[model samples]
Target: MLVVQPRSRTVVVLAAGEGKRMKSDLPKVLHPLLGRTLVGHVLAAASAAAAEQTLVVVGHRAEQVTAHLSEIAPAALPVLQAEQHGTGHAVRLAMAAAPDATGTVVVLNGDVPLLRPETVAELIAAHESAGAAATVLTAEVADPTGLGRIVRDAVGGLERIVEERDASTEQRRIREINAGIYAFDAVRLRDALGKLTTDNDQGEEYLTDAVGLLAAAGAPVGVHVADDVTETLGCNDRVELARLRRLLADRVNEGWMRAGVSILDPATTWIDVTVDVGRDAVIDQNTQLRGATTVGAGASVGPDVTLIDTSVGPAATVLRSHAVRARVGAGASVGPYAYLRPDADLAERAKVGTFVEVKNSQLGAGAKVPHLSYVGDATIGARANIGAATIFVNYDGVRKSRTTVGEAAFVGCDSSLIAPVEIGAGAYVGAGSAVTKDVPPGALAVTRASQRVVEGWVQSRRAGTPAAEAARRAAADGEAAHHHDASGTVPGDTATD
Candidate 1:
């Protein structure tokens, strides 16, 4: 159901928790799940609610966390809490930032990234309709032992909330738990925040205590128990983070699997936040598609490959390859150990064989790099045959260089095209040649070392040998003489044989 739209609602994200358990210099909210920040989910939830603005409350490692959030461009303000007092104290710091606020203020947890927009809207609507001073978002947990329990009044109205540390044995029986999310009348929230005291057991001002104070003052305090606890799960540790991510992955994978993409192992395949898999695309086990990577329709990604910031066109096959910042066109095949670095482009039907590395190069349609080769800073034209072990010697002592091969050019096995070199269309580079200059069309460039032999070398050794050894050496010398004479060729001319 569409909830009542508020005149204005400012979402206050509480990311100030020390999160000491994370054990990292980076803020807890910065931990990535499938290539997106944990706090991004909270911002996304607020956006889904059509929030007028979102405000993030930051404290520990606030600067680093805020810097990262700046990249996402959330529709919210950032409220800094300098002191590590408490949750209430954290939200209180936001008062000066949103002073004279009269509409709804939806308080959210920055580490809880699984929130849904619908639930947030409901929280705001519940507060507005009832004109409540404060409304807490609650969920029924099977075991609400560690969480704060929502203590409802006899008439099932909001009475007070007690933290587990301060709760009595009787109060602990309440299965309904506080999710730490709230929507309050901005004016009343501002007023109540000032009156709050740090009299709790932890010597911290508890936000839940305000509910009791509001209720006792005859002001309305509301409650909105969300249907699913999973949406409210807060990630403070690695285990919960993984659990929440698996939950999220299941949702994302199921949607794609239903949409005709094939995931061989849902448990093993991981996809990033912005990746898109086309129809009938098959993603095998342990494959990770991250950072805006797109697999086109009918394309097959590895049972074990990592693709980052790359695009694979339809029917392309990338098997066991690490492709980063590259583009693989339609029907291209990248191999079991191919590495395509930044700016590499494999055009339609191009083949990159095992152990080959291409960096900042463009392989045109039907071009083949078969086996151990390095093509860096080069351009290869259509139907070019890159024989085994070919290396585009692109880097000199100071600056990197480029090599260009034209259409139908053949680079023979073990050949090196030293850059600033170009092979004209239909040109050939003979085996084992290192071509440093351009080769004209239809020409073959052969760079071979001279061959020389010392005649009667074995006969010379016979002078120091015994009689039998000399005889044995004579037989081997006859065979060696039969195999060669001059020009490194035997004198068995076909008709002269």
Candidate 2:
């Protein structure tokens, strides 16, 4: 068991390659994997290992990479590799910029996002215990094609690393491959890097050359084989990027499942690495929790939901909703179909029901906007009820205003509350009304056209030629029947006589 102090180590991430195979203008290291850039994940691993300082070498699209690093990991120092050379050149630039020059230096590839921090720690531990000038992280993959092979001595010590193009027939048969990660003694690594040459087949200074150089100088070079070969996988194109994203997503979901979060369908649920979910929260199928979302205990989300930077309080239920930068309080209920935009906050036991869209508004405790409504830039007080098809018209042509519904206010169906108006506490708004003015407390507000009745209108329109003739015939028949009855004669019986 070997331990390396965090303060005695520096990490150098090689990210200067121009990933031309990706067929896009964005730098390969900037390509996103599972909601985070490729290099961002590598930086996270370095941080997790508690390195004293991490240096990132940037070349292609240096400005973009540097800008992103500032946002995510500002503590990390960014060094520019002005030349688009090999990995060796990138590491040299990073090492030059690193503050702890006498400490151990661990070099990692930025495109390998799945490499675990624990593995990095293990590599450093091996390097320290063996007292080796260089320790390479190796993996035994099924396929050795297009990868550098690790050549070991007869005594099973790492002798040298040979790239696929330079390897002999027998050397290519070796299954163990270099994973492009190394832990090196700072002083010895600097010496080897100084003597590196571009005389190889590729005519580029190779990092693997340093490993051989250290070995040739009678310095012990150790090899640490990775347990999981997939961790060594690197993204070169869009296809590989997708593969890595899926693998990382699976890893994140499995961790949550083990921590008491119920994911009904792991395959259909996508959660970002930055998301936090409390125990007993059930995430249903087709849910994507992205960008710093936090779900409290006993919360039920999805069946079809996408929440970005949203917070769900304990015991809240959000179903079939899309929310961004919203907050649903404890015991609140939202959606079978709802959209909650930025700054929309729902208080405890509040309900935003089907077909409702809330933006930049607050729904107080026990308030209900049940269906077919849009509440924007407004506030609904406690116990307020906004009826179906109601809309708070908060936007005029040039500017946006707000509407306030006081506590216990009742807004009727199909009504519009024009902006800059307030409905007082316990106020009643009639159905089909378009309210434009504020109403006093406990007052009834109705702004609809008065109704006017037209008496005998149907009869006047029906007094036509055919209608009058029919009425005259009916009157004659009735009089004849009355005469027969007064004479005590049955009209139908008189025919028999």
Tens digits of per-residue lDDT for model 2 on 368-399? 99999999999999999999999999989999
Residue-level lDDT tens digits of model 1 in 111-212:
877788778877777778888888899999888878999888899987899999999999999899999899888877877888899887899977777677
Which candidate's TM-score is highest? Answer: 2
Q: Which ten residues in a row have the lowest lDDT in candidate 1?
A: 456-465
Give the worst 10-residue stretch by lDDT in candidate 2.
1-10
All candidates' lDDT scores?
A: 0.86, 0.91
Off by over 4 Å in 2: 1-4, 452-497
**lDDT comparing candidate 1 with the true structure:** 0.86
**Measured by TM-score, how close is model 2 to the native structure?**
0.90
Q: State model 2's lDDT.
A: 0.91
